[model samples]
Target: MDQRTDRPLSPYRHFSRADWARLREDTPMTLTQEEVTRLRSQHDRLDMAEVEDIYLPLSRLLSMYVAATQRLYRAQQKFLGTGDAKMPYIIGVAGSVAVGKSTTARVLQALLARWPNVPRVDLVTTDGFLFPNAVLERENLMERKGFPESYDISALLRFLSDVKAGRRPVTAPIYSHLVYDVMPNHRVEVDRPDILIVEGLNVLQAGRPPRDGSAVPFVSDFFDFSVYIDADEPVLREWYVDRFLRLRGTAFSDPKSYFHRYAKLSDKEAIDTATSIWERINLVNLTDNILPTRQRAGLILKKGANHLVSDVALRRL
Candidate 1:
């Protein structure tokens, strides 16, 4: 058993990258460098070594969890004398903005789908659950776009409910980064998949309880497993600023982009603007809402500089 006291008083079993890599012994490396290159987010650095050292082991562990859950579900159904309807196993990925959670989700989706038992794995981002820009502007929540209150929490809960109920052809709203808003009349359909990954900054958060004393389901309540991607605040801020500058040259440069104005800014001016946004919005959200929920995750991926995961903390059973 690998154990450490680095997180003193914590309930998680810590593992360094070397120890974690050993857990994936004999697991084949199925992803190619080209595939990893395409899966990484813009300006994010993810290479084959990182995948082998960190994510390959993660995928193998998730595979075992999924299989065990499937068996348990079958046992429950047999005991209930119910038919063989399978519920999708949901995995929640939560973290601060620009912490590479999206990349992790995408990479896992690609890897898990290739597994023999998990032929269909879909990823749904909570970004889609965010209230439309028009609604946010009307409610004076534009400044708190990524905050928990800015999302359609009830709708998100209902969607998860339907998914857990094995509903087919479930549709979720589509959010566009280029437009910086949810696209009205646009939606993504999720058929019954074997596994579903829900990725967002608030996916691990516990929702506010209703006043009626009745039980209200939280977004995390639907997750079978949850992951939190973490890094030092200074490192995350630097990464955010670097990504912002890189995007200014690509996405922001497009005339139709919502942030087109940023494309014309000089390097120094862009850095200043990015820093301001981080300090004002992203940092506040991370400290007040996101970071507090890190301990709630079943597994935590702690990253070092250059976006490499240096350590992992698995929640003790």
Candidate 2:
């Protein structure tokens, strides 16, 4: 047997998050105490320390990737001797629901946007690419909301392709967390962004073969870099439940919120419902689809039970 198979996986070999304070030196911390406090109110346990530690270094790393991508684009432009406009440095952020993927995307967008050369950053979530409620209902897959089948895969692929091909002003549907659905009339337009961060639960999923056996490209194929946020299954479950309860008090209270039904549930009932949703949908998707794609990421952030990133896994160049 291989010795590697016998030993437990080494976390630090990925990227140790233990001494994050020190590694944060290169990244800027511009948020005021009030700003951080407000953000923390929404993200409760997060603080300036966590931002300085995990996100700071992460921002620095992404800056490097963005710079390199720009250089590559310029070099290709020079070689081709054509007037092709430079495309955005596209990043794919992937993880299970409630795994902090949205937070990661937002933070990265904020940090990357500050870089001198890449000031225009756009963040797009795959939630908008999900099939409409009516379609899902007709397909009898309302419960499979975040599953791969729930998406308009071809549309998502074309959108990424157009953005990567330097198309001007690509529009993607907007998903309202309050409504827990995509609003047909509301769409976000990304017009020649310097950096485009595409975040979703399954962005790293592999492409399926065409029924006619032709090759097909996946959404991830257009990414210059990718991130996978990971945590223990139980920790993730707890986070999901905790976030649900918090939203129950906040967004779920909105009369138009699709999850308003959940807001009325008692604490124990809410916990049971959260756990059931995890077991039935999110957890199954994570194991069957998301976790297997971790190795495909350029970097992976592993979180501990405390919801703080404990390790970073960067693919060996």
Per-residue CA lDDT of model 2 for 13-48, tens digit only, reads 354665544666666786666655554436436667
- lDDT per residue (tens digit) for residues 207-227 in model 1: 667878565558998999999
Off by over 4 Å in 2: 1-13, 19-23, 37-44, 211-216
Which residue pairs in model 1 clash with each other?
none
Global lDDT scores for all candidate models = 0.91, 0.82
**TM-scores for all predictions:** 0.97, 0.91
Ten contiguous residues with the weakest lDDT in model 2:
1-10
Clashing pairs in 2: none
CA lDDT, candidate 1, residue 5: 45
